[model samples]
Target: MNQPHQPSRRILLKSAAATTAALAVGTAAAPALAAPGDTATAAAAPGGFPDYRYVKTLLKPSQLTYNPTGEIIFPCIRGTAGRLSAPLGRYYLYYAPHDAPGGICLAYGDHIEGPFTEYPRNPLVANVWQPHYSVSHVSSPHVMWNESAKEMWLYFHGENTTTRLARSKDGITFTYDKVVLSTSMLPAGTTETSYARVFPYELPSKNAHFVMLFMLNNTTNHRDIHWGWSADGRNWTFDQKALVSHNDVSAVNIGGPHLLTRGGSAFVVYNKDKTSGGDLMITEVGADFTLRRHLGRFYESAAGAPDNGRSASPSFGTEGGVPYMVYESGERLQGSISVARG
Candidate 1:
């Protein structure tokens, strides 16, 4: 958000299958340079669902509520690269703020359109080295309400080298449950790990399942966003490994995936950093959970960020019976909670 100062650091597992659960504070990876002159257009299809209009800015430097913790926004997620997970009556928006150096916190929002509340004992998470995980930046959140499991599942890519998970009955105030799937959880042939995302594909399921898709950073510019499946949302088994790749050469840092279903087909939305800014790209997934078509670019960031992911989709059942997106915007303005609707 601030003039991207480099982290002197870059970390990921030996392979992409290894992952870590992020939502802590202070931890970060060395900012990589944007792939030059990329992202003029989407390579696959395009993210063309509906036009996303700005709803409101939730947290910002000038508008933040000050509390005793430090600065009012002091206890926010540093990465702001987060997502919105709404069940029915409850809404939880995760924030990645740099509470301090090398720390990341999981901030929460009750209402999608909000004067969102920052969790009281924020920085609800941190990355501690475990044999199962590799230490690194624990940020970039994607949350979901697992109806079948009757539990709230939080997923994010952290320093551990892959996207990891922890479960909670209540969305906020979570307990570190366990990593959903990693090299350890896989059968074989998939051990490479790194920080990535795994969001639920919003298709009404009879199979009692969930789908997670996040970037599998195999290389600096050669990362791929892959998918996985789960029966209980606790233990996930691998599905299609590589879902999308850099078919988009005009863009870079292009992976914060959001999946929503319409007409029995699921639409996947992601972002492409065009250096000038970021644009939301969309694709479709069939009932079988295989990649379908790239719709078009849905929305574009004003200042445009190549670092963070702008990956939020529309919830038709949200208040007002309209649709809205809880995504990170104002990245050029130090990032904050923002809502977008068609």
Candidate 2:
């Protein structure tokens, strides 16, 4: 089912000067300034506000049995399926489907609201990692579960100004690890640096365990939100300014960043894109990321439903305690991969 085309962010604006001179030869180092104090205690588990209004459509693209060019989007969930010396399912649902053979897929469910099951040898991670390089398509996927490397890291993107890293002890075979973030590590008119999301916070004096939130895309194409800091999630360092912009949400740009801690307080739950529609916003992430504060509308686009107005790349989770999200509902390469709960 590969006919509908054009959308890999316009094939990363026609190869962005052919991968910007090999992406400035491994650039990623220049983010040192995390010493202001008081702010580092968000182990994520208070989950107070979540009124995602009971939406549905859990996975579509005609319920893929293995479909590409179908437009499923970035929705990362994991409560298990790592640390696996045996089991392959208890929950784990990373997704993809951007276009042009776009991949990095997987699905399995015991329940996180799912009848999910798709991994009949699915893309797993494609666009050729052959002798160690190849691109044209690979979409946004973000998985995490590295309790000191028991394993499963997997952030993704391909040629949309790069972001990569892979590793897995289980959670289905991956190993490519490197090129942790690109667009020459951001800023100089940036130009597309994929949608990422990684968390395990602890920074202010540094020895940073890990923290990343992405989506850049400048040179006038707008789009904001940026950050990086990793002691060892596979070497990363980037902060060339912008932890959320479009002047901090007057909105025409802002992107799909999700790092919602709630109750230990640390937020950056994004997606604002507005000519008049797209919502899901919230800010308040202080200390060292340099304090931002734009808390407004955490979900909006219900009127006609099916998110035709836009609700983008989100991915929050909680189960026995309830809260849930997992978004990207419609428009933007024509979407679907929904779920809301509170």
Candidate 3:
């Protein structure tokens, strides 16, 4: 494993201060901030989840990945959390670096606020689907630890068209499993099914253990959010319903569905392309994973800056009851990953 070069405390403080100032004035209403001596808990945002304050950047683009030569890679997207290994006392982050020979990668850190060290044997999930799909691209990973199965279950897409599965006892080494869901599982007219979030949770009234929210593309190139359920993490049955359609929201494009559970309620955070740029929106999902209550836009791009291009591809995780988000923002093709707390 190659450890990240740590920066000095003074450098970190100066960078954080600049980022905080930009966030404070970027939006019309500044998010609630934690007090001077309060490094443990973030203040809650009104009409949002409690004790959720927007913290500064966690992993900037320059920190995403590195080549064999130790050169920094850019344009990393959809970094998702698996589980906090109680035994190891570390958190696992699986992300997709949208570069050549693309595949899923892994990073681990002692804390969510991290100088996360990248696993040297990265591309943990390699681009082995080339012969089958004719394209080696593999990205958009969503991973979660399944307690009942005693393994970390990873859900990701290949060539941005189908969803697949992999499992690992330890978060590092993974064995490829079958394709759990794909366009074949969607309705007759659907074109593709990709970019999914899979996790284990009991419904308010049912004992079903697995839930998935994925993207369903149509003939017109419009992408809608759909969901599915599974008795186990491997087998899935599509609900054949659109959770968020293009017409349902202001944005023309809607993708990147991430589920955050807090206080016994489940919230879905997704990305949308607004007229100005892009926005990250949230909605409350019913315990059954059917009913949705839109929570409006949570983060938007800053005007005339690198971020003004767009803000999309969000992943959520919490540490010690404090919530954090890692999402892609900046000029679309040249975008980078940024972290915020709430």
Candidate 4:
């Protein structure tokens, strides 16, 4: 974690940096915006959104093993893991399903990387209402341990125009307790009352009081990721600038933001839809929250997905003290999860 004032005494990186499918692979192949090592994947903007580039391949997709019977399922974007700030320990892997609207999950490991397990009491949904009794309203979850509160939290997107949340004690279980923030609470026309966040992430700077990043649809009618900080995690105020917005070639929907602290800054890894099969992109942001420069495209699909699809969340952290990424791969229709290491 970067302190508010003191700069890290490490590499001055010019600061720019799920799931399985037994499902179907989308139809179109996304343009190779930039090859694996091309730093130009990220374009520079004047003063609004900072320029960003892809880092290296984090977790590329892999199979989700059902510990009990060892059965693998489809669409394993699962859950978001790791703590947003320091003392980052608790890692929650959520299974994408509607069986339990707020059915929370727990996958605890000593280090960021672990052969994590699916705890039996795993699904921790308190009183959450599912879309269908068969479908869980909880999707694209970003779970983390809040140091200040001395507990773990589940921040996720759901049916309502708002994001829902629940708190837990043992990390694995949550009391589907509350609806922390919903779009209905925002002033009218806050970019369509329907825009909702997919995944929730923690910002590195502690100075922001309480900080979090989320995604929403804009007037331009595209999806863009944004941030919010609360003196209290429950009462957050969003940042003025759209943390991330529409791109020139892409229709602009940025979902699943994962933040990693490396070199000296926090590098964000996410996905972009270029009107074709989506490509995963990355970039680095300064301590002041300014976009730095482009990194490059980590990996491009050898094929295209049918729904013009791509998964947003990418995994990043020190696994076995060695950095590795655990992300979902392939297109939904006939895709499965795969893993990669640097």
Backbone clashes under 3 angstroms, per model: 45, 0, 4, 48
Q: What residue runs in model 1 are displaced by over 4 Å at the alpha carbon?
A: 1-48, 61-90, 98-110, 129-136, 183-208, 239-241, 248-250, 303-317, 330-333
Q: Write the per-residue lDDT of candidate 1 for residues 205-321, one digit (tens) a residue.
A: 535366776655443544455677665666666654466655643454555565555545566666564452465666676767665565556665554342253333222213222
lDDT of 2 by residue, 1-342 (tens): 101111211111123343343232211111111123422221111222434553467788777877857677888877663246555566678888888778888887766668778878988889888877798888888887778877878989888898888888886789887889989877687888998888778785777988999989878887888888888878888889888887767887878788765345577878887464687777887655677777677777654457777888888664433445778877777777876654
| Model 4: residue 94 alpha-carbon error in angstroms | 2.8
Q: What is the TM-score (0 to 1) of candidate 1? A: 0.64
Q: TM-scores for all candidates?
A: 0.64, 0.32, 0.75, 0.60
- Which sections of candidate 4 miss by over 4 Å? 1-92, 98-103, 106-117, 126-136, 185-209, 218-221, 248-251, 274-277, 292-294, 302-311, 333-337
Model 4 poorest ten-residue lDDT run: 22-31
- Which regions in candidate 2 have their CA more than 4 angstroms from the true location? 1-59, 66-120, 123-141, 144-152, 155-166, 169-196, 199-204, 212-267, 271-278, 284-292, 295-306, 314-327, 330-342
Better of 3 and 4 by lDDT: 3
Estimate, for each residue in 1-342, the C-alpha lDDT of model 3 and write its tens digit: 001122211111123564454333221111223333334332333224433223444444455454422211122222223333342325555666555556677766656556566667777877775434435667777776666776777777776668788888776677778788878788787887877887666763444677888888878788888888888878877788798776777667788776666445667777776552476677777666666778776565555433554667666554433345566656554565555555
lDDT, candidate 2, at 331:
79
Leading candidate by TM-score: 3
**Model 4 agreement with the true structure over 1-342: per-residue lDDT tens digits:** 111112212111122221111011110011112222334322322211122222222122233322322211111222223322332233444434322343333443343334555554544553244542233344545555555665666675555355666676655555565555655554444552222222233444643554565556645666666666655667666665566655622535655555544334545555665454466555566545676554545444334331124433454433222223445544442333333333
Please list all clashing residue pairs in model 3, or write none if there are none.
Answer: 52-342, 53-341, 53-342, 55-341
Q: What is the lDDT of residue 273 in candidate 2?
A: 70
Summed over model 2, clashes come to: 0
